[model samples]
Target: MEETYLSAYVFKYGLEKALKKTGNIEEVTSRMIRDVSGGVRVEDDISPEGLIWIDGDNFNTWLKPKIGQCQADGSFKTVYQAAEHVAPDPYSIYPSSGKCTADGLVGADGKVRKNVI
Candidate 1:
């Protein structure tokens, strides 16, 4: 008997499609093997962290929600709210009074505070 392995490009294409369909590549990939008879194994040589860099700057908006304010106790707070208005110039040092502060406040010790709002 001979064995064949799927190429990285093919796997990536399948993964992208699965992610688009389920919105979760990891979960979908896991489920796919579970549903198979021989217990198909897919090698994920791609670093989980590296996935963030795939699209780089173009993915900034998609990654923004994941980047949040860290609290002094190491907890995170959501930077944007569904109901609140997002600032047009979040990076501007002198933002408009009504704009939300994009940068989370960090203490002198590099710890974030819970009272950021």
Candidate 2:
């Protein structure tokens, strides 16, 4: 797998509140669902950091009460939540040498590549 990078943001309030204010949850949800299947690819060396939103269907519902500020009364202070099924980042899950992207994978030599998945 290739080494991908995604910048995460942490706000004073919980993820739910922050998303509601910024109105970025919808965009995130759409990208996660359509591109990464509601999850981000990771490996032993690579790990997702920060609060990830799970059970996010156009902000219809959130899986865990504490997403970002995982404290008392919806305080997402904790970075990681066990029950959250949300993805950390955007589309990723392809061989590093293939140069995979949102559209598909690309071979290093630029040949013999057509990812079905």
Candidate 3:
């Protein structure tokens, strides 16, 4: 009912122009990730690094050997850049081998807190 900036843009420029946001990837991502969780503000520092996918399909631990300091640096560079968000299979074939019996989802056992003693 109300004519917003988006509608005006679509009428003036076209749907594609209105629907798309154009900006540098790092700046865009920094804008996107700005918020606080718990007591820590989770905003990303402005940098030129784009989002990268580290292939960790067979690792025994989820984050054992360290990983991607990723960003959304260059998604619009090419159509294939869309694959940055696509994650590979995140489960090891042997789920019960390398660690405790905790299945990896958060709150898996219906308990909110898993006390580490």
lDDT of 2 at 64: 31
TM-score, candidate number 1 = 0.21
Arrange candidates by lDDT, descending: 2, 1, 3
lDDT of each: 0.37, 0.39, 0.29
Residues 18-104 of candidate 3: C-alpha lDDT, one tens digit per residue: 234443433333223221111111112311233222222221111112244445883233213342344334323544223332233
For candidate 2, what is the lDDT?
0.39
Worst 10 residues of 1 by lDDT: 52-61
Candidate 2: residue 23 Cα off by (Å): 28
lDDT (10s digit) by residue, model 1, range 15-47: 565666677655686545222212122333633
Whole-model lDDT for model 1 versus the true structure? 0.37
Question: Hey, what RMSD does candidate 1 come out at?
Answer: 19.0
lDDT of 3 at 108: 40
Q: After superposition, how far is residue 87 of candidate 1 from its true place, in Å?
A: 55
Candidate 2: residue pairs that collide: 54-86, 68-76, 69-75, 69-76, 69-77, 70-75, 70-76, 70-77, 71-75
Which number leads on TM-score?
Answer: 2
Top candidate on lDDT is 2
**Candidate 3, position 9, lDDT:** 27
